[model samples]
Target chain A: MTDSGFKKLVLSHFWVAFGAFGVASVLGLYQVVERSGLIPALQSPKVYFASVSTHGVLMAYVLTTFFVMGFGYLVAVSSLKTPLWNPKLAWVGFGVSAFGTALAAIPLLTGRGSVLYTFYPPLQASALLYIGAALLVIGSWFWCVIMLVMYGQWKKGHPGETVPLPMFANTANAILWLWTSAGVALEVVFQLIPWSLGLMDTVDVGLARTLFAWTLHPIVYFWLIPAYIALYSFVPQAAGGKLFSHELGRVAFIMLLILSLPIGFHHLYMDPQQGKGFKLAHGVGTFLVALPTLITGFTISASLEKAGRQAGGTGLFGWIGTLPWRDPMVLAAILAFGMLIAGGFGGIVNASYAMNAMIHNTAWVPGHFHLIFAGTTVILYMAIAYYVWPSLTGRTLVSRTLPVIQLWTWFIGMTILTTPWHILGLLGQPRRISSVVYNSVLTLAWTPYELAMIVGGAILLGSALLFLYILWKSQTAGAPEANAEIRYAGYEEPETPVPVLLNDFKLWNRIILALMLVNFGYPIAQFFFTKTFGSIGWGY
Target chain B: MSNLIPVHPLEKRWIYVVLGVIALFLGAIFYTALVHQVHPPGAIETIDSATLHLGGEFAEDKLGVRTDADGHLRATLVAARYGFYPREIRVPEGLPITFRIASADVLHGMHVPMTNLDTMVVPGYVSTVTTTFPKPGEYPMLCNEYCGMGHDHMWSKVIVVSRESWKAAAPQTGR
Candidate 1:
């Protein structure tokens, strides 16, 4: 394929992804300020919920899906040294998803689907929104197939050689997504769509929630694996060091793929429908998922430490100071690591079945998730964009200094914003409140934190605008020569041949299938077998 | 092959250390849950959500604080769109009270923020949490779940009072 052809494929998807992010950022600012009720003019529950729902769907589903798809293409082409298999089908997927996004946006923007992103049923939205969401999932399925086909083709050609780590993980994510989305896909098609279109009088809320739980938690890893891919395969090289261990990276991905699927029931711990035994089983699996994250943290940190040492740093901890702080990717990895530590702690707390009651459904949950999803994952996405954009667009960035500025403001702003959010959750403030305008003493205690959040929101908004501006300038710039080459971090290959299980996924896929049946089979089957009640749709 | 680098022994040691720390953390959480009696929210019983208001323990007239078969003080509450059934709940202070909560509609979560009392009130199943409020006070119980358009206004309070005051007021039955 021509360079221009590949660039077009990558850039088209990225534009949609970033476009959604740009809109969501503005809506997020609106929510923080409106929730504060600091400005009476902005205080409206109807609008707040609408904006929140749109913001969530855009950020969680639209942005992550498109970005992952686009980035997966770049990884496939670069790592596999192959042209995109079935490019026409890839375009078809993009078109379908984009159309779906547009269809979903209509009801969301018009306040006709203020059900928030969870869309927990009995609270219904317009049929268009449900159909749009289903279409988006279907479109992503096309990307998954294309990815797997390319992966299989590369493996066929390479034979005994190990697949490139980036492509390996990318393909793993594609597989994970295909499995992860099946639960929600089943729910939307069989349960939500029919109920929303008014063809069904009543919908089973327990079954709907049970199915959603199957998808909910693993989908996070789908969004995250790209960020992790960048960390393992890109950041070490960007930081002027080798990957600490390539073997560890493969292990982490494999563990994540296997463990991420069965563990989603932890999200339903607070819910009534699932039994204690099932929740406990899922909780155990949830704790296991944290293992891979911890390993990633250690491996990446060790890689950076090696980089710092290579730069002539001495002493046990002095290596940290010697590493590159100016490189946007390196800086993002460092900052993202800091946020991940805090986020990981919060996750451990959330996964602890008993302690979850203290923070579940509170503002603390959002605080914890934002730190993970927005803080750690999204920052890495920015870093990946920064690294890849120049190569993809064939132009030098307009301003080098602006990216450093953007990363800092985002980190600082998130800290300022989420710190008070965690506190408010502890102080008895609920998560989805439209306003904290209550004049009571309990509500008044949240005033200072509310004010702090507004300031943080403003800073974050400015940072987001700066990010968009930087991307725009880079894309539009005219450079002397195109810089289309990508440099991934290198690590020492094992002197002995790497194990087949680490290299190929056939056995692992079989294992995952069995595990899924064992872990999820009974829980999902019981829903259909049991005497369950279906509730009628109420909300619009 | 040219770019490949070998893993250092020290890095391997660090990996072990990291894994050890993770193991310790998980072990601690399990210990607290199993040995320390820190239990999560859920009951063994299942109820038909559509007929919640019709019959059995969660029926409309049978909601709120009552004595269970085991002679334990049990409180039953229904979570639905816009409000919690028996919106006002009164429980005696300084007693181990088991709250049996369920949702009549979609997924709703009950969180009284100041206390270790938050659980999802989903349909078709009952979530139970046993706890004691040592201090006598009015704890505002907020529906933290995003139920619907009226979610913001879905606020209720649980009045925790002394046993003497509780007897004087009497446990009001039925919604």
Candidate 2:
């Protein structure tokens, strides 16, 4: 585990992941408090949107991307049992992404480009913001190249052998990201860049929206892949069960990689720019993508159940309680997975085509995503941090009890905050309103939810503080414990080869090529075919 | 020996049955929903004879509203620029009526939980919103979307009329 070959690269990624996460958490607390509207002095819609936008981009895009990249490095090195094909290039990618983060933060913090986190067109950010975001993606592109090279290099070195499972999942994620980023990259480079630079007099909103649609939804899988890898490779074994069908795990990853894109039209469902036909096409694709999630849910949930049963729980569902809740990783996954079920259920309702009208542009939308991203995904990221910190830094985790409490309080707070958000959406509360100042019936309905959200925000802020404290203290105060080795659960790799479709990327690549052609071909064609109507030139 | 060992429970006989059932159910539902969505619009226009016919009730079962021949919405409003249609368009217990609705002017979004009807009415365009009334008590026909200068007063009422009174105030009554 010395810093020579594989561990060196893995450690580099882990450092970046934790470093970004710690900073993001500090910003997250500020965001929640300011957004609460309780602090009148803090209430500036302009500042609030900028903060909200940056906070979202950091946690969702920046933090998640870096952490996932780091985790992928670990999987590649250990599981593939190979040195990273180009460590120097991997470092180059890291530098690019970090530089991009710094550049993007300038406009975000200064209110120079407060287009909110989602860089939808008509409202443009500074050219630096677009360039910075592009560089970040470009850096990730380098990671993608390295990943593919490593996979190919491994296969070449060991002819006729199956790829390692974690590497397979890791590479699947890399491919997913490459495909996922293309949509927005096109939008950013072509539409946003020109608009921001004032090179283009008028930008096509529909075209811009259509191109972003390509990246909008699939990018979520980029965030979720590491979590999925953990679910497949780490969670089952940690729960004292065998990998519950390795093939199922591979199938899920492949399904996810292929299915996530092409259907991003689900986001454009309400927008008039994309036609009903394309919407339907993407809608069906949306449902198809759900299959992988269901597989993950069933496989992971069943694995946990089996783990619980083995630990001496009784009854069909009774095994839930027998599992250890004390371990930070275990406790975190349990809480995180619980959020996934609820969040995933809300997603089902959202993707219901017609039912979407119920929640579109409502507070429910953010509520649902926060539950998924912050509640489920970030908590697991925390778990990964907690687990890796001791091993990586050679220091004991300070206040293990605090990490557990932080995870729980975070979970409880997210649920309390988000449930009311859903109800409020139904109660006709718009998503991006600055404040509620009415005393009448509809406004009165919002009061209880707003009050509950304040409580939730406070709890979450406390949890964030505790998390940073533990990580900081571990860095400084914790006793040294050298010979700190990284560990994985005892689970035998399944001997059965997954069908070639799952293991083989070749077929999926071709399939994706065809699907994208059909899904996007005409929809994008229409932008060129028909004359567009525009009012405001691109606003920078 | 290159003969590969199958993964744990390689031939999972039990999984086949369960997954098979799930696949079947999923396939059926997927097809039905797809068909329902893709089907050509069934334009069933109602004949409204009354000057003001009660349209979609605010309920939990259906969506949108149904109207009669006279073209006036057979509906209720808590207040309109402010007005609620006469309260007698009632259905029997558990029976849900279709609310076919359209606005004569600006955009107004409507929702009633008892009938589960929610949709918007746009001017000129015959906007059809529907719902079924399940509960008996008067429910507020909330203007979920803001409309006018008088938006605060834009509410309507729903009087879930029983079958007996419904017949008494039937179109033949002309009252």
Best by DockQ: 1
Error of 1 at A81 (Å): 1.7
Model 1: how large is the Cα RMSD against the reference?
A: 2.7
**Model 2: what TM-score?**
0.79
lDDT of each: 0.85, 0.67
Instruction: Evaluate residue B5 in candidate 2 and report its C-alpha lDDT on the 0 to 100 scale.
Output: 32
lDDT of 2 by residue, A1-540 (tens): 445445555556665665655566666556555545667787655666666667767777788778888787767776776666778888899889989988998998897766656775555668888898898889888889988899988988876677867889889989989888998898888888887787875566667767887988988889988877777767777677766666667777888988897888777554545555667667767777777777677777777887899899999878888887877877888898899989988887677555666666567788899899888888887887787676566789978688888889989988887898778877766565455533335556676777777778678777877787787789678888777655554444446444556566998988888999999988888767766533233232
| TM-score for the A-chain in each candidate structure | 0.98, 0.94
For candidate 1, what is the interface RMSD? 2.8
TM-scores for candidates 1 onward, in order: 0.95, 0.79
| Model 1 stretches with alpha carbons more than 4 Å out | A437-440, A493-496, B1-12, B54-56, B68-70, B163-175
Interface DockQ of each model: 0.52, 0.06
